[model samples]
Target: MRPSLGRFGYPKSVRGYAVQAPGAPTLDVFSRRTKWLQKERAARDAETSRKVDYVRDEVAARLCERLLDIKRHFPHVLDLGANACNIARILTRPNPDSYSAAPVYEPLSSRVSALTAAESSRSLLHRDEDLPFNNEIAITRHLLASDETLPFAPHTFDAVLSSCSLHWVNDLPSVLTQVNNILKPDAPFMAAMLGGDSLFELRTSLQLAEMERRGGIGIHMSPLADVRDVGGLLQRAGFRLLTVDVDDIVVDYPDSFALMADLQAMGESNALAGRDVPPIRRDVLVAADAIYRALHGNDDGTLPATFRLIYMIGWKEAPQQAKPLERGSGMVSIKDVLEGQRTGGKSGNR
Candidate 1:
């Protein structure tokens, strides 16, 4: 169902884990304790010297492509859930290393102003948090804000972009609808979120191991949004000319343990509020490891883990932009076209 722009209230707060109504779709699932998730992410960022922000880097690269394709420079950009201001650095950094560089795009640092947020304002950046982009210009403004509640005014930005972060929000549609309302007319919006297929092998192995040992599988991974549902979400949030695409990135790991470690380091580990089980037993871990190796191990001894990044781009509706054609206005008939193709095939056979 489409989210209404007229709705102004945020989601109701609940203590601990809370489940929706019995018949509600699984996508509407809730997480009651995202505070720990936020803290975990902040702690991860704080520990790293350079911040191994691969997902954020990938997100910035894709947003750069969108900037190139649209041929528009947004003077006032907002980086939603902008962890460490990575997108800001990508869009602004001069003479970035080849490993993370894009085409010589416009200098967003000079022209575009942005607001970014971490779990808290203090935890936004690494070592260079206080330092500006360079000596001359200011970096993206960092704030303390949660996805469920944005502390900004309406029509505040020309563009809104996020990377690998929105998937963790408990009330995604509400956050998105708020984003829609705050963007100026004709503004560009893009985001990348983790998709449903991420960590398939690990999820499978864990479930199998848990069921065998404890007669049930507890939540071990966060629920991910399906790529199929995102386009509809953009429309529901009142976006136009929406485009949604998925990029599947497979990384080879020495084993499932290494993959899990990386996930923990990246603060992408399970933080589901509905998880009812206690910490997994050592036997369960060994069994899951064996199961993973049997089911998805590589000949070279490296296991593969998939990270599906679903990228969505849309525009705030504008009066000047073109709209889709009305139903029944098409000039061609499908039946006639099929018949013509059939006749042509028969003539070719003769």
Candidate 2:
């Protein structure tokens, strides 16, 4: 079992870990977490992204060719937290050539109606059940809400592709276990999730200001777990062909408050279940905004909010002869490993 952590919880990047409340206290000095939200964020994520429908759909289109190459014979697929059903939308509109890499595409999603008029689906399975599809299912962005475990059979899916999810979950190792069990030998699993440094400005500013105002400290923002952390997770999860990539998009906002509102709009709020909940008074909120502007704002009074995204691609291992190395040693060839340039971590291990 992992070691116990206090109110701030554990993640490498969390700067201020103050449990005691600040100088001018506002609300009750929140000792324990109040009523639990019961992992209710899933329903909220579905409802909010309708306005951003095109973004997901466009993501699918961009990955079409690469996704096609991952599997042959139209492997059974499952799209998780499939709010927009964008994969189905792109599948129907195949390239000009009559022949493509995929066979009959099956989209099993929660919001069944979200599938475009042109797309097809096998069945609608609940997120907490054994998927309706027999084997070789693909999923994305579904189980990352609150570290809730996934339900599926071992060695099931031929390949899994997840786009823009997994940042919210804390049970990285458990999630990887489910992935390894459900995926077949040597099957590919690729995903895109926000990285630890991903919304640095937005996350750090909020955390610091909260610390400064309330004299209390706990991770207030939705802190991102980094790429190395993810790569290590994949290794522990039993994936062999592992590759993690980042796409850092620095989004500009007029003010830090505007950026904070955008986070709410995206339904990506902090959900540290069993965390301390101190009341944030009106003045505290006002002070936080000012400090956020002071630290992260640019010369023209605009704040730079970084959205560093990580694209990870890994696969279950096919049976091979084992040539054991030293405990901390690797059998990998160095030249072949520098496949892509990456930041952070010691050398190019990730």
Candidate 3:
């Protein structure tokens, strides 16, 4: 069944998910129906889906690692856009190698009381629903829902986590606000999304190839978030104590065809709205492959594709949360301390 359209042409299925707060701009940059179809198609072949989940797995592990650093227990958590349950799997059966520094293998589920895995694609969600998880440790519930419109009550969760899913969201700021609203006061929200020059090599190669062949370019890659703007978004969403950082994960492929194929399997193919442009000409693909090799090929004849991941952490505002001291409350002037250090602890008057 096809998803009906709502305001700004969003999927009608998402209307009941949540009401968009007033004044929150609904950007129609992505086609939710197309995204769902892509994910559903990707999940059709289990083996191919698993093969392309390496990037998601890595990001989930890293996100969980950060979550583990917090020395607090989360009674309930939400895994937003939980494709294939990557975060759930990591939390339930954490790899001992990832935490070898610890004295023992402690499951992240031990700290999280319960988790809800919400996904936009039903096929992808069901693929992992039957996985043999230790239910006594990890109590997970699956929900088919859109990340663009979170269907949850206010202050419903102790924490919210997402891995490599927010990038596909059309109205990111609105979704972030929903995430903050659903999280309890002072609860943590941790997530990672592809952004900031991700797939630059392929993007550049495709543009150049199209320009050379067709004398024009098409939108080949989806636009991603910039790391610099993420902090501001968190603050705008009413989140405090924000932290944002980036990491690059490069994977080697035999050629551009292999890379594109893997991306399709990963359910990350371009789903930009109004992308009804004609299929890329075969000649352009040929030229793009050649250009890709010439530009970013490795010494061993393999091509390297970079996925830039932006990791962000923010906490819901709470009255009891720690706050910075009032302005000018410092006893010592920073300038004086810097000058003293510059003068080797000697007074400037001397």
Q: Tell me the TM-score of each prediction against the true structure.
A: 0.78, 0.60, 0.86
Better-scoring candidate (TM-score), 1 or 2 = 1
Candidate 3 regions with alpha-carbon error over 4 angstroms: 1-22, 95-100, 134-137, 329-350
Stretches of candidate 2 above 4 Å error?
1-48, 52-65, 68-73, 81-147, 299-301, 320-350
Candidate 1 error regions (>4 Å): 1-51, 93-121, 124-137, 331-350
Stretch of 10 with least lDDT, candidate 1: 113-122
Using lDDT as the measure, which candidate wins? 3
| lDDT (10s digit) by residue, model 1, range 1-350 | 64434445654444586778763244435453454454445455565524546666766766655665665656677777766667766766553334545665455455554444333333544435655653333445555545567777888888888887788777776778888998999888888888879889899999999999889987878788999989988898899988899988788888888777766666566777766767778888889988888899889888888888899998889899878889999777777677768777434221
- Candidate with the greatest TM-score versus the true structure: 3
What is the clash tally of candidate 3? 0
- Clash pairs, candidate 2, are 21-215, 22-214, 22-215, 136-156, 136-157, 136-158, 155-181, 156-182, 196-224
Clashing pairs in 3: none
**Model 1 lDDT, residue 63, Cα:** 63
Pick out the ten consecutive residues of candidate 2 with the lowest summed lDDT. 116-125
Model-by-model lDDT, in order?
A: 0.71, 0.53, 0.88
Write candidate 2's Cα lDDT for 182-276 as tens digits: 77776777666767687776666666776787676556665567777888888888878677876766767787666666655444556555555
What is candidate 3's lDDT per residue for 277-331, written digit by digit as tens?
9778999999999999999999999999999999999999999998878998988
